[model samples]
Target chain A: MTEFQAGPLSLSFGRKQVLHEVRTEVLRGGTMTALLGPNGSGKSTFLRAVAGVIRANGPIMLDGMNLARMSVQEKARYCAYMPQLLPPPVRMSVVEVVLLSLRLGGNYVGASAAMERVDAVLASLGIMHLADAMMGELSGGQRQMIGLAQALVRSPKLLLLDEPLSALDPRYQFIVMDALKRETVLRNMVTLVVLHDPAVALRQVDSAMMLRTGRVIASGVVEDIVTPEIMAEAYGVRARIERGSDGAAMVSVEGVV
Target chain B: MKERSNTESVQRALLCRRLLIIALLLSGLIAAVLWNLVCGASHLPLDLLLKALFSGPDDHLEGSAGVILWQLRLPMVLMSAVTGLSLGLAGAEMQTVLDNPLASPFTLGLSAASAFGASLAIILGLYIPGLPSEWSIAGNAFLFSIGSAFLLEMVVRLRGASAETVILFGIAMVFAFQAMVSMLQFVASEDSLQDLVFWTMGSVTRADWTKLTLLSSVFSAVMIWSFRDSLPLTALRFGDDRAAGLGVDVRRVRLAALIRISLLAALAVAFSGTIGFVGLVAPHIARRLVGEDHRLYLPAAALSGGIILCLACLAARTLVPGEVLPVGIMTALVGVPFFLGIVLRREKTE
Candidate 1:
């Protein structure tokens, strides 16, 4: 069964088409599935469509109900979409942003519960020391982590992250992705992430939906479909996909063809 | 958790500051009223003034003092306080909701709209023979104030809906309104032009109990309903997109704030002519005393505004040998130096 229940989605911006005949769904309770694509490949567009920030042609169904049909408050409760992870557009403290996520539901989990959730997410991401920092004061990578911590407070049924790990340095890259993977699995959620590179794809993501020109180039389980042909087609690069002695996946870009 | 505690403490201090402003304002208003009654061109002793107020209807101890206090001074004092209270709080709301420090009703073209309307009434009265000029003047003032508010809102919307951009657009509209008012002035008969000019300068001598009562009621209602949204409005200092992500509907909040501001400003300008500077500078005083928290900023602004206007009116009635200075000029002159001091001091501290 489709984990996502999206229906007949269409979108356009003025005279240009952003999403065309776009349809996607995950297996319920799936792994960190990456929405892989080039620039303007509609990855961010699709993520926002699911979050209902922008109105689109089709209905996104979570567990079979139409998503846009839900009220703004309702959609916010079921899905937490982290868009581009820019430093919060204001001087709000990190704790304020995190607390806001829990408050969005109006369930307004009491102070203790709200703090516990914030503390847990911050600890998981290893950024408890910077809790008091203003969002505008943080480094890009640190801001991205804080952004992730904010989304994690809600523990939604589905998480839509736009380039969740793109700006992160190598040491913290896997750590962030690993935490996302762990949270999705432990919480039994369906997470759709947008990723740019193969390093993130082969190392962390469970499935890949490679898109080009607003169309899906490939989609399947990580090992079966993340082949040299699809990578070359999607990124326009000649690439090598190999299995090492340690039985880990390896991808190298030979060059653009 | 610790930071949350800090926020709460800051909020509490702001509340204390607001209450202090309220206490100070009430005391100042009473003192001004008494001063207006006592220190007139004729120095009536305290005993005679008390007799005039309390004695039997038939036993008239002082005729001029009673006429002066009841008919002239009381109404003017009340009008000054009411107009200031409404305009100041509304200005605070405008600055906060627009997220621009420079926002005020005057900056947003409202005062110019009022001036244009008053100018039109004066210029047209010579040609039109039968219309009640007083009603025409008040009606035109009220209509144009609302029209300017709508125009300001439209320009702001057209400018991409950013708060800062909207305020800039409003400033542009103010210049347009002022240009039209200047054109109207260019053609007026000199005698009528003098009356129009004095109205533009803003005076409270025309005040009556009826206008005072209505303004007080309208401002009090707006302030009460708006208090619940004060913390949320401050949350907007974090920016609207984030505020919305945190459960505030930014557009809805902005619209609500705009309507209240429009209503209050239009009423004040209509009833008391075009008072300026009260809206622009009162919020700065409130912010300095309390801090950036709107929950307190708004009420403190309201009270401080009332005190400033009442004291200015008292000075207008008593100062400069017998002539009454337009309260607007007095406020503008005093407010400029004070605002400059605050700005300079703030620059040093920062």
Candidate 2:
């Protein structure tokens, strides 16, 4: 299994440091980790830094290879990042956009093979029908799914998704999370996703990291990280973890701290 | 499995349609080129034009038809095609890199800067050193256009290479250069002012064999370089962070596109004066025809540009019977209505 380790990543935008010397435990492949934080907690910034979309003062090691030493193209072979924003409604077709990701990532497959891979990814995400649709004509939720398809089409070793469900409906949210889980296991990839909803994190992720004010306040299993004290400290909310009818753990926020 | 095959068929059909559109555009360009050659001030018969074309420029023909075909018509026709291709290709890259549909060589101020350079040469007799007196204006225009592009590149390097920064800076440069040209125009002698006005109107009539060769070579080289980066440029349309996630070095790609735009725009403006609207309209037409896949879009846009300019050249010749209106004015006349149609149609659809 592949191992993804990011450590001591410090990033600054002008005078403000968006990411502190934050570090993560050795996240292994075939599992999903939810990056949980309140607003302005640097969840997106952390993902951008680790994905090498933004420069940060730190080292990222993927399967014992120093990602810092690798070129952007080389690093992309091992990692695919989905930004938080939905893709603007461009005039390109859905399949063309996904194929563009594969091509730009330097995964030069034959045309048939590339189409096959793209088809498989889209089918797995239940968006196969959208392959021929123009992105400009798709709804915001559909565009979000297209973005996910693009990130998964290349099947990189690591997936960094920032709020992949923000524009998704509840139905699509479950669909997307399920597909990401299946893909992560089937491809043996490490997936780190930024999720704002603690309940979703508790239900969907194998582990969770809680951040506040650019610092990682807690990190471990989902149940361990979503505690009352940590929630109070991180989100300024008095919260309780309750068992649902289906016996899944859920975070119920009571009031402000 | 059935759905997958259906989707694949749809994709195949789309590709075929794009190819057909490109074929149609090529044919249209050929027809326009032929029409441009035959319909000048003194219309030559098709047979005589064909005979002169077959004999080539080297053979001395006894009739005026050969001289008119070789010396007068061919250079202007070829110049229209080359300048349109350069501006169209450059505009496609510009729009993609800047992420703005309105972005073009004219929008980026290259033409205005070149016009300013031409004004200086005409008004103050300022010319580039070592150029022959006849070539001094073109040389000065080329140098100044290239200089403006260089300054723009330096600004992009120093500041962030964001699309907004480049476009805003370019718009500022447009106004600045335009103001400079107006200042020069104010102090010019009546004859020099008339000459400057004519030059700014842009004419394919000024084309010569040497300028054609130089622009064609530069265009071919830049086009090859552009096609090499087609995939990355396509990815850039998705936005900068996502393009970076897809392994494109966004800043580097933007800079490279800027350099190519510089060479193409500067050279075209230098040789053909300040032709407008082809760069702005051609890519939109190409996009409407073939979508935004740069692999097809670049060539389609270039072809569209070439056809537009060729038809403009033809119209410039035929519109007033004996008088040749400036081709630049013709493009503006045609382009503004077409541009409005695109905008109005988009409004209705959206």
DockQ of each: 0.20, 0.80
Q: Candidate 1 lDDT, tens digit per residue, A1-257?
A: 22675545678888888888666645577567888877888877876777776778887877877777876667767777777645444444577667656765567778766777777788777787777666667877787777778677777778888777767788667777877888888777888888877666877878877777777767778775577787777778888887789988888888997
Number of the predicted model whose TM-score against the real structure is largest: 2
| Model 2 Cα lDDT, one tens digit per residue, B241-299 | 89989898888888788778877876777677789889999999899899998999999
Q: What are the per-residue Cα lDDT tens digits for candidate 2 across A69-128?
A: 777888888899989889988878998889888887776798889889999999888888
In model 2, where do residues sit more than 4 Å from their true spots? B1-6, B118-172, B189-195, B338-350
Docking class of 1: incorrect
lDDT against the true structure, each candidate = 0.72, 0.86
Candidate 1's residue-wise lDDT over B1-350, tens digit each?
A: 66445544543454465578667766876676666667757776777767776764345457776776666666787788888888789888887776666678876777777667767776776323575455566557657876876676666555557645666677677788778876777777888666766666788887887677777888889998778777567656655544544445667777778778877876687677677778878887787665545666788788778778877887876679888888888888887776567547746855
Write out the backbone clash pairs for model 1.
A9-A58
- Candidate 1 TM-score, true structure as reference: 0.74
